[model samples]
Target: MEHSSVHHPEMPHIPSTLTLASRTPTVGSARKSETRHILVIYVGGTLGMKPNSENSLAPVAGYLTTEMRRMRELNPPSDDFAQQGSSSSSNSFSSAALSNEMRVPTFDVIEYAQLLDSSDMDQQDWLVIARDIERYYYLYDGFLIAHGTDTMHYTATALSFLLHNLAKPVILTGAMVPLMEPYNDARRNLVVGMMFAASTEICEVCIFCNDVLLRGNRSVKVRHTLSAFSSPNYPALSVMEAQPFRPRRHLLARPPTGPLAIHSDMSGRVMTVLCHPDFDAESVKTMIQGTSKEAESRLDCVVLELMGVGNTTSTMARTLQSVVNTASRVGCLVAITTQDLYGSLTAASVSRLKKSCPDAIFVGDMTTEAAAVKAMYLFGKKLTAAEVKEWMPRNIRGEVTTVASRL
Candidate 1:
């Protein structure tokens, strides 16, 4: 089923909104319970970027699948290739890889009609991917997303929230280098991610890169290197060396018993402000008070990116409480998170912020990427301001660590 998003006039291909076909009921199809048929959703990124006319790296249509099909390890030539009669050229080609290896599962690719640079993705793109999984939920055993590294963390976090009670692995992967280039990391990332996606033991959104598996919401792109992501506050759920066992201990204990739930209401708007010496409450007041009549433009939450100790400047402290009171009245949420990558907010700082902004949420140890998407998820689900605070500290998706500290 082909689906197209609402396109922008200037950027015709990149849609401002996406629409997916209605979900179909799971008719007792011929999907073998024991078989691993992974569905790979390829949303373009650096993994498939090729040099174009200006000699600048850009995503080319049909470039990814063309390059990927040549990987013998993924689509290995089988001796039984003669079994498929005349249709062997296309039919046998797909089946041959099915018997490739136990670790190498058969997969079908659904390339987006308009390949998006990861930077071009929006909340609607996340919703489209979630609905895609729902539409084909009954057909495939697992889902793997090929995304750009730039905003992979955001999409991964959004998916973690949008797709609830997931019963299969949803692994997102992309390389710093494009697959068309020699000596690139795309193959290793893709192959390993495929294996994980095919595994029945893992049942949550995760990012597999640089030989390690990090929880989707817990991950962040640390640098512009092959080692793209890191789970700073938590240990990796699985590593290449400890796979098939490490996940057993560190990952979600077991797949959820309930049927998978998909939440498409990620319409929440949020803003991030770094607390500097110039940080002031007046600007934040304007934001929470509703800057525009456009519902989509208005913010539902504001993430206060605080210092290492989670405290802001005295400049902003002057009218912080009053602004917070306005936020509470207008149904806006105030979230506090530390700037440190590895360290979480302290109890003393959290208490102080909580005292000042009674309705403020102390996002403990959550990466800014995770925090931002989480706010969008919460508001998009139509949660009340009180509910946002209620859910903020709780570990709904393994994104935050509940730290107990003294003032």
Candidate 2:
């Protein structure tokens, strides 16, 4: 991946309303916040990508505004769309051009001056989104993130852990295909996501795409289809057809009582190791306990992606015990998660894993993505090793399901 400074020099670290409502495709001002008002943070993604002079598709800053104006569903104007340089900012982006069933919201769109592919995103990039939401927490009733699909689930999971005490909607969305194409789900998904923000009380981080609403931490990128994401170990929060979302209220996350806060501190030292038939104990040892040159080898945490029910080779397990023991002595957490999509670690699995590696934290049913971010979030909070272990398996952000509930 290219360096972030080379790509994102123009995107504001502290978000400012850059696209003017009067001369741009936006509908409202950042300074004004009211009930039913939505804020769209257009973090560069394929939805806004356009053919560069080289004919290769690339994210072009402010291009989404152009396409949105052309779509009568968002601008609702019959005029020459390209000539709408000074269109009214009081306009609404709604389902009118498509349908009248979904709620129409007055919204403001903010774009990064320099667009970067989400594949290059890191903890710092995730921090930017979290901080922006924190600054504008009280301004809008809900939030929408127009992001790239490559890492959309990762961002959703990171945000779920980074933003604490969330009491309003924070929906992440992106298009499988670009809006510049003759036909795509770009406009459709955006309309539906905005409608959810305007009409629902889903008071936590969520991902909405291809008519599927999923808990952010519970979501996974399943395939290249229109619905590229799924909550493999969990249930869909909502599934909308011709009508608006009839969310399973019981599945929705309840809002916390305290005011919203962002956790800015995070340790990127965590690593993910996958267990396989050829999983070498030497490589695992080298990973968990760094070389002699780098003495402090126990990273902040290590996510062990094991086979079904958190099983591993008897030989590898015995070999890993020594390294895990070393990492455990120095405050490094070892979280165990299953490689199977629907797999949940059982008590027997935990018991067996404990015998092999005494310092393992059983992370039942939480997707590998969730486990990784949860580790960084917990470590970022400066939590002690014991506290991190205590919280790893507990359902903090609806990421993990109860074994009893599954039964």
Candidate 3:
């Protein structure tokens, strides 16, 4: 059955938002779990950076490699670097080799070319990251992406779509502070992210921070200072505490059969418009035209950030029409999403999108980040326009959900 967001007449469209009260830690429970081989793909972020002798920050890839190797050496029987799909007997022997006194799980590190800052990340960066995941997909039981929080959600959501039929966990994690800092949050989060990735209970893309694990597609960075990322319209899969981290497995997507397929052919011909208080024809025209020029081929999709309930001032009506005209003429799709994070916009708020651009798709309640990446991934795939239209609203990997508005 097709699922659309539940409608509220009074609040035609609103963005998703949240203010969560911290939950009390789960008490007095004993649960046992297995240790799986995990791959740590370190792309330079705060977690993988440190201040140098000159007081300049540089990628701490060397530090990560040395520390991890030293840890593995201390525990000679460490099975962290062993390849995946090796026989169970082999894994058992490796696990035993590392299991001298303390039975700690082994992990491997593969540091790619590091990004100076996440802000410099672009389409080419995404491709490299996706290919890295592909290269290690068969070699590791699960994977972790240590990315900058600036665009972690985007990477997570993009990879969720790019890596299809994924049966193992792909967890993205980073910290608010650098690992060199005295009390940096990276240590706990990275360790926990790896643990969660290794868990058989989680079979989807996720972002782990502040000890809480959220569904990748549903997560967004909410606070700059705090380690926690929020899933405004959805609940987290699990929250890791002092002792035991309990995962709500029923909330995650079921794994698909067959080997993992990484789609590196993202069109990168999409645009995202940020909404403001005063929007008009001239401004809208400028944004739409500017983005069109930057596309790889013809523009594929344009995601508009609209005001409350997805509505725009009447002055911008022609702007919307112009987007519809230009996009439709060049075989592009234009969509409208709310600037707000707590509520979804109505298709009626973007009525011109539905009528003028018949093939255009509207993203209801999805973050601008997820919507843009999804459009790029789906644009030139074998999927038809109608299929794109339909799939946009469906929860392929729990990216979007059908929930009633409380507005």
Candidates in order have lDDT scores of 0.73, 0.73, 0.64
TM-scores for candidates 1 onward, in order: 0.82, 0.84, 0.75
Off by over 4 Å in 2: 1-17, 20-35, 76-101, 292-298, 309-313, 403-407
lDDT of 3: 0.64
| Cα shift from native, residue 258, model 1 (Å) | 1.4
RMSD of each: 7.5, 6.2, 13.5
- Model 2, 51: alpha-carbon shift in Å? 1.3
Model 2 C-alpha lDDT per residue in residues 1-407, reported as the tens digit of each score: 12122112323344333542322223333322322567787888888898899998899877886665555555544343332233443335423233222544656677777677889898878888888788767756788899999899999999988888888889999998888888988888887788777645688889999988899999889899897998887789889866444667888887686878875476646889887856775776666676544535458788878774335566657656765786776667788888888867677877878777767888888999899998888878877778778888888888897532100
CA error at residue 349 for candidate 2, angstroms: 2.0
Alpha-carbon deviation at 177 in model 3, angstroms: 1.4
Cα-lDDT of candidate 2: 0.73
Q: lDDT at 391 for candidate 3?
A: 65
RMSD of 2: 6.2
Looking at candidate 3, the ten consecutive residues that score lowest on lDDT are 17-26
Judging by TM-score, tell me the better candidate of 1 and 3.
1
